[model samples]
Target: MMQKEWTTCFPFLNQMPDDERRRFLQSAVPHQLYAGEVVVREHSKCVGVVFVLSGELKVYKVSESGREVALYSVFPGEAALLTVNCMVAQETPVADVSLAAMQESLIAIIPSSAFFYLYSVSPQLQQFIFSCMYKKFNAIIDLVEKMTFKNVSERLYEYIRENTGSGRIPLYTTHAQLAARLGTSREVVTRCLKKMQRAGFLQTERGKISLLEKPEP
Candidate 1:
């Protein structure tokens, strides 16, 4: 029954015939994570693939100076396949996984050996893998473009615009956290925020930032 629940969370598996779904489910092992747990880490051996049945996970990389730059956030019904690649290639993981639970969560762990076998035999699984890889690849490309060509202010603006549906973005982050997200120093972020505040673009008080302008395109 738990296996059925795990399979249901994966959209790719939903279309599969029952027999095939059962085969896929047989390859997975159940696992649980607590809030604030490190599910994976940089330079660590990857054990298997993770299917998040519940909860959220933040995928990030730590800088040499020990700063975390968040890459993406994963929630229930999403899976992380990078760990499978690492185990298959016998290489260390490139990022760290931090579990953030709004509530308790469960996951299905599929061992690398079983995953490889499934990939070899299942055409549907292959297509799913390909689609996932393509999306991840495109995301990395987008990140590169942002880091290389976009200024910190632009990035911050984009971040704010993306997160807030309305023109007014009520900021709920500290200056330091904003700096990390912008890939700049806290002083720089503070300076930019001050400038924007003066221009009526936004305002900040007690670590809260609010966007006053709709942000220019």
Candidate 2:
């Protein structure tokens, strides 16, 4: 029987026919990730697709100066299929990113060859891949827009709003992390944050941040 938690992470898998799901699951090899471990490295030959079964993974790219810029994060059920795409195309990844486990995690890896064979034989699998790709593309578009049009403060606010979902963004990240996401220096982020705080837009405490007012859209 498929675990209830697994269904929550992979709702689509729950809808699949039992036999199909079983077969697909069989193709996935399980592995463990310790906290702070790198699950994947950019430009490394992708051998398979990896799906997080538990915990959180931070996907980040290194800037030219070697600063880490966080791209996004993936939790349970989210598969890093872009790596598989790179492998299939035999192309080097454009970004130098790594997947670091924020907590202990379990991952399921499916070989690229097996995935291709299964995708060819199963229309459902193909549809799933396309849908995932579409969403990934949209996310990339959103990121590009933010990076291009928004200032550092605006970008930081947008990220906080989206991640918190409740207007109140907890300030757990370091200033250095914020700087990377903002494409600036830690001092710059610190100065901007202080300015915002003085303007009554936000309040920052020890490792915590509260949004005091919504920025004008």
Highest-scoring model, TM-score: 2
Candidate 2, 4-45: lDDT as tens digits:
766677777766778777777878888888977887777566
lDDT of each: 0.71, 0.72
Count residue pairs with overlapping backbones in model 2. 1
> Per-candidate RMSD vs. true structure?
3.6, 3.2
Model 2, residue 143: C-alpha shift (Å): 1.1
Looking at candidate 1, what is the lDDT of residue 102? 26
Q: State, as a TM-score between 0 and 1, how close model 2 is to the true structure.
A: 0.81
Regions of model 2 farther than 4 Å from truth: 1-4, 14-19, 91-96, 102-104, 166-169, 214-217
Q: lDDT tens string, model 1, 35-137?
A: 6567777767777788778876666667789776666566677667566566666444443443233235687778777877777877877887777677767
